[model samples]
Target: MAAFGQRKAQRLARADASRKGGLDERAAPVVQLLNGRARFCTTSSCSGRLVLAQGSAADANSWEVQKKNCTWLMVTHETCTKDDVMTALEKATGDVVLKFEPFVLHVLCQELQDAQLLAVRSTHCLEVPLSHKGKLMVSEEYIEFLIHVANRKMEENTRRIDRFYKCLEVALKTAISANNSPSQETENRSVYIHRRKRKTIQEQDVHTSLKDHNEELEPEDDTESNLAIFAEIMI
Candidate 1:
């Protein structure tokens, strides 16, 4: 844990040095809260944003260089103009996707259990929804969560982005709210523990039933992958 803190501080220093611009006004508070905690530390994060990305053809480069490949025609932490969206579209050579991302914080927790506790506490206590994306690249490091205020979706994509942009204030308010009460945190922790135990029991039951039936798990098929590829091509 001490080692983790050292590395995290080092990274934060590097990040601070690398930043040429100021922090997003809306995301600053959330970032401060996560960084101030002993049990939690923020990794890479962006306050929710709207980005105009060119299609895959424009990304002839490697997937690892996707960030470089995609032209961020517009990057905003708050509501944006429809005129700006139109301007980006005019500049796009390939398909353009307007991605509306909510303020997302990739938080590192001291322990796996601690990750769960933080997730529930932040959501239930602080009204921030979080997604548990499993472990990090470093084996010695701790668990991480993709904590954000919104869900990623392609449904009515542009319309959704516009709508989210319009309601950006509400989202920002929730993200920056000082709603973390001690009682709420305790209740959230208890609920998270209960859910974890229940999940473990369910997994055990499934394992026992599979053993009793002597049923072997089937190998994964490539049908879904092929279908996804076909869909991508069609798109």
Candidate 2:
């Protein structure tokens, strides 16, 4: 566990450096592997989707560059609440958790965004029983996967917000169109003059013709657009 902490500290430093645009391709994988969670299954060989950490972001973030790196790592956190982690060992069902390499635990948690929206079903942190084989060595690949999952979730949220805006915007446009009806009023460039109904047959005919002409320029109904308006900007 001492070794895991040391390596995790190293990865955090690396990630912090990377966040600051210090891109070292080789160093990156090492950081992620040593500091990230690898999915595991207790009952079956095939693990579920997510391999989120057992405790906090720090726990989830640190992973082993090689299995040897975290072999000595152990769980020490006493406060494992379900809100941010999974600590079934202590009767705590925290979602965000990290499994020490020695223990295999099953835990249910909500995605970082919404617990209700997504059921992150991956093993919390499977401490590979020395007997349990099959990729006992944590790989940097899982780190990449974690990043992808986070990005996809963020994009989904952005799209949802965009759809909401589009729906609202379309409604607003419809309302405006209804109120200042284009048909009844004339276009500014080609002004429409609303006149009283004339008693004379010729005058009435002219008035009727003008109304018909104005109706033609009423413009297409500002209504539903099938495509989502991704950029809803109100200026």
lDDT leader: 1
What's the lDDT of the predicted structure labeled candidate 2?
0.31
Off by over 4 Å in 2: 1-140, 175-235
lDDT of 2 by residue, 1-235 (tens): 4554554444344433211244233223322321243221111111111223322222333433232222222222122223222222233222222332211122222122222222323222332221112122233455334444444443443344344336534654564466488764544313312111112345457668979878543442335211211121110
lDDT of each: 0.50, 0.31
| Clash count of each predicted structure | 2, 27
Root-mean-square deviation of every model? 19.4, 21.7
lDDT for each residue of candidate 1 in 105-180, tens digit (9 for 90 to 100): 5678777754654442122111211111111122211111211211222223334334434454354345334345
Q: Which segments of model 1 are wrong by more than 4 Å?
A: 16-22, 58-66, 120-235
How far out, in Å, is residue 216 in model 2? 61
Worst 10 residues of 1 by lDDT: 127-136
